[model samples]
Target: MSDRDTTSLLTPELEPQMDSLNPEPAPRPSRPRQMTLNMGPQHPSTHGVLRVVLELDGENIVSARPDIGYLHTGIEKECEVKTWQQVVTLTDRVDYLSNLANNLVYALTVEKLIGDIEIPSKAQWLRVMMCELSRLNSHLVWLGTHAIDIGAMSVFFYCFREREDILRILEMFSGQRMMTSYIRIGGVALEPPRGWREAVGKFLKQFPSKVDEYDELLENNPIWLNRTKGVGFISLEDMLDLGVTGPMLRGAGLKLDVRKTEPYSSYEKFDFDVPVYTDNDVYSRYRVRLDEMRQSTRIIKQALEGMPEGPWQADAPKIVLPEREKMKTQMEALIYHFKIVTEGFRVPAGEAFQAVESPRGEIAYYIVSNGTTRPYRVFMRTPSFGNLQSLGTLLEGRLLADSIAALGSMDFVLGDVDR
Candidate 1:
């Protein structure tokens, strides 16, 4: 072979190099470095069947997308087939932790459609008391599970210990612990059960101290503070734009509770302050809910001490069910009871929207009636669905480990989200 050809074969062509004094590194391939992770439709920290799609750059999240509907119940569509009265049972499952709050919002929406049906003052006060109790139940569950998510195991047991008392009180009133279906359209399903005052009074008396116990366990703990305090922050404007509500909204320093801003079910009669904090972070949300539990206790005390004396149900024989005793003795009462149970009472043809403060946030029901026994259309504006919208804003740009703290702070129920 020629010398030139042998030299060409021995040495490959080389690219020009930079000056030795100013050497530049070779450019890296321009492709995304992010990895996508699925956090769960089964992961325990999700608090329900929620799947979060996360894009991560190393240990930090680049973006997050909440993929929901793993727990969809089709409850709103189910309502179209059920009688107005029969639908109350279904509401209890929407947010099982706050069943009474669901029951109340549903009952209030029906009552509005029925044209100013006069709910007794006693019933109103009782509804308020029960709803507050439901709030406490929800907050307890949130705190317990959230603490455990952050590795504070002891707080879970302490929270459930107090929660058992609230559940007992609820059972006394409705005869069912979680799915009571106690709040009816015209009024509550039945008069407050005997000895309810004593049961609730005992819980109220001890609950403040129980809350203090939780505070001691979490508020000053270095591990908890490190995990939560400055993490999971989203701006107030972004939260509002995303339609986030409940303690998340309150924690961002916005005083927009449905109970306080738009009172229903005699909530105006109760004197309680809506807790607000300015931090707009996970710890602020924790503080707001703690303060809320105390306020709920205050409302329950007022309801217990000043419960009015009147018929628990409305005077409308056609709408409210007759007493069992009256049904046995009186033919008219028997017919009304039979009709309400079998045929269901017809609401006037109209549409009504009622919003109430549930444990998670502003839960509103928009119901349409065609002057029929069943609702024409039923739609629920659930807080979990609204608050979940902020997940992207909250988790993006945060450390992957911090996602758990941010998610736990939102306190969403999947049933509520997907219903």
Candidate 2:
């Protein structure tokens, strides 16, 4: 009985042909045409040199991989070579958008190690003000570039218009624009300019209206709505998985903010709001940043009103550079300066991780000291680096063209990532 159909298992085509006498042609399998696209490391919308390789079928993206490190400058490794104090200059280049914030975090880390050096209350307040203002500047650049990418050109101009003022204020305090490097290890690199109060006040007075302009221009514009609303959408679950933070995560309705959750640099003294949103899309992100500027303004105003009166640097002359005036008259001051410049200060053996809410997200410094002038390892957990991790995830299944707005909204700075 088992041998009845044994020939049916024969692995011969000719033997099977006998069963049908004429075999119908086998059904052909369907294969969708694959379209490979290269969205550049040089493209304007990418915000920096980031090339993304994408596979698409029709308007849907099948897969995407972000190719970065195009702007690699080895800043992190270079820190090992620079002096603990000299490293401030290099910090400005990291998130170029939030240079002062970078300067503050690093300087503060090393400062904390210095023995019993008193950081004046005024200096701390100024630091908080500067850090918040830097956050606004960073968000401004992001909004302008991001809006331009999504076809909102006017918002770009309006955003930069205000950012120019912020840059001027930073320059007034530090003698430089984007790379202030003003926040020193002990305190600030320079004293606040005489008219800084009026200058910053005038700018703040006009800045709120400018934010409103951005809202009016893009908030309700039909084109802006169609392009951004519900686009480049991400969820809190995905954001948490990808380690996303900052406005992007908050826009997804997570009320987590480093400044509020983990206050630093006297941030707890400031009274302000942390804007949140339930729609984690380009439009909502725009709203979040726009409103964040308002919050930043409130902090700055309070800081200006309560501007403390004291020395800007830590009282330790051994670690902090003495003022040029004091160095000329005082022998002890001159010797301290000479020693710091020639031999450097000795940091105790320890490891500490310090995080600040940078413009893009959390900018953290993981510094290890081996009781020497040089750090054993200094790792920067740049916000852009963390934000960049969400790129592929946010970009998957999106339209090929939507990548521009999506990436723009991510506000990734290659320098931040490659570092």
Candidate 3:
């Protein structure tokens, strides 16, 4: 056939329009669609392994959902298997930056269950000093890392310099820098080192200047201000509803420090301000933490200057380990030491909950003892877990870049959250 005849025979008006065989594609939706982005479980800014799923409309976060549990160490469950005293070490791993705080809270909780045990005045003072130093340490880390995240690299170096001094002091006290676990159940793990007063005095004397240096660097820098001031803000009501605490809550102008309100471990004996701010933003949180470091120094100075003269450990023979000299001299002391070492001290059959103001926020230990050496049940109401609940709230309807600042302001430790 001719080419025209063949083409016409094949065409048939494009095969009867093909409209009956297939309908036209539906019109595209008019509005643009959001896209989901996975931030990370390994993001350096997350402070640990924490993944944030963000639904973004262009560069604005439409919604944010945190995917946690990547760093679940099962430390809480591990606590149940450990002796009451052994668990202090486990607590040290929970919020490592605030290791002393965790150690103190767990120690205090166990002590509460062991009721009527008189922790020494010296020991109490020592605990206050160590914990406040821990607070300083944790806040220093937060400031350094947070500042670095926002492009202030010098602050990280300055903050870590002082932090190194604090870590050395911790090492001197407990022979370990990061996970000291120095606050034992009835008292500190050991007597304060001989030169501890001088060492701590040196750091405290120098620290205020370092904080001022940080302020000089970041407080007025236009880039820092633009990144933090009035950014990542949430109302006090929303914060409270989300269980936000620590600097995040304080930044909202609430005087809700657990140290002030509850006064555990002789916090009432110290005089300091809670450092509240009405702004409720990243800059406010930054200011609050800086002031907290100062207050912690005040508490440390008080603890050092007026340090009580007495035994470092409680007189409770059953709970606290006996002195080595006494163990060598007295048979009864030897027996108690052996017993406490071979088999852990038994806690009275009861439940006790003790809360403390950690660097992150309120970290409470809820413990049940069935009159056994091992805990019946151990649960930690960790601040990071509570504070992380607000991540989604803090990021929603905000710029995608603001998410890191908001996360850093919360200062959450994933180990604390996952436990």
Which structure among the candidates has the greatest lDDT?
A: 1
Looking at model 2, residue 278 earns an lDDT score of 87
Model 3 misplacement above 4 A: 1-27
How far residue 87's Cα lies from its native spot in candidate 2, in Å, is: 0.9
lDDT of 1 by residue, 1-419 (tens): 35554444323334334323346756756997889998898999998899999999999999999999988878989999999999999999999899999999999998988886999999899899888888999999999999999999999999999999988988899899999998998898877878888888888789899999999989779999999888999998998999998999899899999987888987888899999999988999999999999999999999999999989888999999888899999999999988988999999999999999999999999999999999999999999999999999999899999999999999999999988
**Which has the higher lDDT value, candidate number 1 or candidate number 3?**
1
Look at candidate 2 and give me any clashing residue pairs: none
lDDT of each model, Cα atoms only? 0.91, 0.84, 0.90
Residue 65 lDDT (model 3): 94
What order do candidates take by lDDT, descending?
1, 3, 2
Give the winner by lDDT: 1 or 2. Answer: 1
Give the runs in model 2 whose Cα sits over 4 Å from its true position.
Answer: 1-29
Residue 16, model 2: Cα distance from true site in angstroms: 27
In candidate 2, what residue range of length 10 has the lowest lDDT sum?
A: 20-29
lDDT (Cα, 0-100) at 187 in candidate 3: 94
| lDDT score for candidate 3 against the true structure | 0.90
Tell me each candidate's TM-score. 0.93, 0.91, 0.94
